[model samples]
Target: MGIISMIIIGLIAGAIARLLVPGKENFGWIGTILLGIVGGYVGGTLGSMVFAPHKFTVQPPVNHAFLGAIVGAVILLVIYKFVRARV
Candidate 1:
């Protein structure tokens, strides 16, 4: 996939993830996009470790990007909440 498409997907995934997780996220649109991009990377890394083993990049055939993004976003959100509470 292209960088543009990935970014778009990331934005959408982040928004969806934020919605799925009930809480007040202190981030704007840009932050959401960044969150999603990071989430995608995190998801891709974890998925690769679990499913592909040797591979690092997830291809279109697997199309685990969205799922991975959601999982990653949830994780990040949780961490963010925890840290924010502490601070």
Candidate 2:
């Protein structure tokens, strides 16, 4: 999928993840959407590079993409927290 498609997928995945993960305040619509878009891109890039032998397609498997999106969001959130703590 292209960046646009990935962003869409990520947005959906991220929102779902945020809803499901629980425990803290949600990122709101705009932040959640942005996180998802970025998560999709990061997840796709990392997954493809690490799993190069699979001939990773731009159109990633939905499960993998979803997993990637969630992971990316978690990573982003963690980093955000870390940076915020230092500020």
Instruction: State, as a TM-score between 0 and 1, how close model 1 is to the true structure.
Output: 0.81
Clashes of each: 0, 2
Report the lDDT tens digits of candidate 2 across residue range 1-87. Answer: 777776677678678757665456457777887888787667778888887656555765467777877777767766776776699
Report the number of the highest-TM-score candidate.
1
TM-score of each: 0.81, 0.67
Give a tens-digit lDDT track for model 1, residues 44-81.
78887888555657555655678998788878888888
Off by over 4 Å in 2: 1-8, 16-26, 53-62
Return the lDDT, model 1, position 21. Answer: 81
Per-residue error for 43 in candidate 2, Å, reads 0.8
